[model samples]
Target chain A: MTVPSRILVVDDDADIRTLLGEYLRRHGFQAEGACDGASMRERLHRAEFDLVVLDLTLPLEDGLDVCRDLRTRSDVPVIMLTARGAPIDRSVGLEIGADDYVAKPFEPRELLARIRAVLRRTTGKASAVRPEATRHIRFAAWTFDPTARHIVNAAGVIVALSGSEFRLLRAFLEHPRQVLSRDRLLALTSGSDVDAFDRSIDLQVSRLRQKLRDDAKAPLLIKTIRSEGYMLACHVTEPA
Target chain B: MTVRVFVILVLGILFAIAGTLHATAIFHGPPFRPTLQLSVLGICTLSLAFITARMVTRPLRGLAGAATRLGRDIDAAPLPVTGPTEVKDASMAFNAMQRRIRANVSERTGMLAAITHDLQTPVTRLRLRVEKVEDDDLRARLIGDLASMSDMIRDGLEWARSIDVAEPFGRLDLDALLDSVCSDAQDAGHDVVLREESAAIVLGSVSALRRCFTNVIDNAVAYGGRADVSCVVDGARAIVRVRDSGPGLSDHQLGSVFDPFYRVEASRSRATGGTGLGLTITRNIVVRHGGTVSLRNRAEGGLEVTLDLPLAGAE
Candidate 1:
């Protein structure tokens, strides 16, 4: 029989740790809890955990340090939990190689869904319904794995991407070389439920542009279509 | 300096000699025609001598030493009461004012602590009770609504009792603070990035400035998906820009964004709850630091929140 996926939940809050452990166990996964970085290190020594659910506000060592440290040693997918209400922290966490993130006071079901999604993406068992699964897009000497939610540069260095950036890039990759209007991009990425006046997508693009090192003066990968929105002026090859 | 003093003394002596001459002429030599003028001149000479003596002996003797003592210890020896009645009274008043300020600050801090502590139990109890509600949607909605109240209570108490809300002047690294803020947000799963990452230092209350930035950034991320932070240092003032790609506020709604409990979007229901105090608290903190916060919808689409603060150590 295949071993149940061992998930490590690291959080300072005892209640949250217990709650997540109970919830994850109910979802057909083996779960263990660690209150801080010290305990987390000991737990890691004991056995290999498939995935780690880490909180940013740990006691001794901060969550970001743990993330930076963990990424260096292993490819174990980590989903960070942050209480800070800042969007930059989220992007930074991803940039540091956190596989996924969920803000605090998050619904248990959403957390579960994210866990499952991360696991499926890592294990190459993602649903066929993900349209980008069949497409492989290359831009600016970077390879974007939409199914895996991973971006690797030419030297095979994993580039960190926020959730919004991932989604936006995926949209761009799917319709490569085609102009995607802001309204259309919003509809495709954030769904119609998004606020009408939200220019968040534009900011996300700006952030993504920074990561890609795309110059505003002369862009190569993602170019402004003007009057339209942005277009991914790149080559895409579908998975065989 | 010595020449000026000598010249002042010489002028005094000259005036005194002139007064003696005029007085002698008035009393014995010849009947003085301008008796009133001569008497006025004599009085003026006497007054000048008295003023010069006071300026040289009183303030000049003790002013530097008094300042040095005050700098060394806030509770140092009181200013000497030997100068003049007016100066002595002023010194006494300064000591009394210092004592009063200390007492008032301590009293307020204690009151804030008491209030904050008093509030936590109720909020905790409410949170515990909220967990027991079985209806998923109603429970979530109730909790969401309650969160705002709790946040408001927390912020209100913190604001009311903050010791450094009116902080003493000090220099701060504005650039480092912004960078740290951005880093903190980046750690929180936000898509916020510092567009212009340059180090600039300014003089202000560190905590108050932090609170100000936190409020503006929180509003941007909670309402908008991402925030673009930029700071432009212009001489003695640093203009901080926090631009968000959220739903841009209407021109009419822009004015009221900083009003407490005034939310521009009606759809800020349980899912995304804000106390509507973010902007208000932000503006308050900034203004307290002798800074200003302005919100305007960018012509290119998005809302830009600008914070103008006096640069630290700038003249």
Candidate 2:
């Protein structure tokens, strides 16, 4: 029998910590709660946790400080929860080595999905730390800033992206020159629990293509494979 | 300023009286020439008084103009303190008052933002706790209520933040912004279409402008069923129009639609789900960018929202 993954949730709010702990436990994970940074440290010293869900607004020491300190000491995945959904805060969170970020007032299911995704990405690796922080990714005369979650064209025009389109594009940029099937694309962008409607992937791809200004009839950027899936027909370079 | 004007008026009246007395005494010796000399002296004194009065009231008129400008924009430049002593002192006081008002407004906005931000924690906690309810329908209803509460809190924060002018202005492609906004709305399954595009560029705060456009489009989709948006550059102004196909609003309703918390009772029911501050925030953002937004009922049974923004190089 497989042992459930252990998770530690750090939040100042007692009710939230307790409720989230219970929810995670109900979903078949060993969950623990910490009131603040000191307790969180003590818990980490006492037991091994697969992931840490850290709240950005703590009593004294914030989640950013805690995550930075944790990064120096350990490679466990940390997902930041912030009440402020500002773009600057998100970029700063990711820059400080957070695995993912979830704004407050988020759905519990969404949080669960994020936690699972982060765990899967970490456990699949030999060393649990994320490969260096994502920087500006360049592909096909376009500059994509993963931290800002937007793209700038060769003419310096910023093209705003929808959530699904961003995720799909990021997925493609991460693995270029490979045929990513519709099911894989769906699972990568919208979690595995979503109902796999094949047409949604095609529609999302077409929309992303339109945003990229890639000709749909004879697409030069993203190519469709017959009886398989789609592939990014371009080289992606990441600059620090 | 008032004291200086009063003194000028008194001095002018005294001079006019002295002139009259001197003219009467000198002309008393003559017969026909006496009447002519008296009348000329009277006209010259009247003209001199008129010139002095205008000079004295010029500072007062300037103060009034400055006050009117301050009323329209809280961050207007301070009144230039170049006048008589009393006028200078009055302008100094007016500038101080303007500073105090600006501080008070910023403080109020900060307080509202802090309060609204703090509400997120409890709302998130409540939402998570709601998940524990075993009954599906009860849990769903509870979640819905929580969602609307959070929505109101979010809107409240947005309204408070709409007055902020901290964002730096930059050249933005209007065509690209509208295209992205419309595409985003369409992606979310809303009935939004970008019928026309303009290559005009405007200097604006990017995120704030995006929010402004998004609020208008969202309102149209909510009340008017679908939004057909277009943009055109006419001379130095870029005009954007968003039209919808639903039943048009009444004349009275159209007038009050942009007012904060004003809703059309017949069509904009609670089920439509808005705090009614969408248009108010939009108008605030538009006015901040030196633009105007207006709503009018279309002849073909719909509502059209027009936004006019000055082109980047026009000013």
Best by DockQ: 2
- Looking at model 2, residue B215 earns an lDDT score of 91
DockQ of 1: 0.03
| TM-score for chain B considered on its own, for each of the candidates | 0.62, 0.80
Q: What RMSD value applies to candidate 1?
A: 12.5
For model 1, residues B1-315, the per-residue Cα lDDT tens digits are: 576568677767877777787778867976665666567676767777776686656753565576665443434566666566766676677668656766775677567546654554445345545666889999988877667766766665545533333554455556656755665577466788887744565666555566678778877887777889998887778899999987788878987887867876753775566667667768767765667889888888788999998765566
Candidate 1 global TM-score: 0.47
What interface root-mean-square deviation (Å) does model 2 yield?
3.3
Candidate 2: tens digits of C-alpha lDDT, residues B1-315: 587567767667766776776667677854445565567667657866776677657878988998988766778898888776888899899999999999998898788778878889989999998988999999999988988887777777777878755566767778777877776787667889897768788888767788899998988898889999999999999999999988888888888988988867864455687878888889888888888999888888888999999998899
lDDT accuracy of residue B125 in candidate 1: 44
Tens digits of per-residue lDDT for model 1, A1-240:
077899999988787677678767877999999999879888998898888999887878879899888767667788888753334466677767776787654545567767775665555423233334224456658877543434666654444454466667877876678999998787556522122233466776776776576886677878887788999887766434
TM-scores, each model vs. reference = 0.47, 0.80
The TM-score that candidate 2 achieves is 0.80
Per lDDT, the best of the predicted structures is: 2
Per residue, candidate 2 scores C-alpha lDDT tens digits across A1-240 of 188999999999999999999999999999999988899889999999999999988989977898888878888888889975255677778877887888887778878888887776557565533432455779999988766545778876666665667778977886689999998887667743333333389998998898788999999999999889999999888666
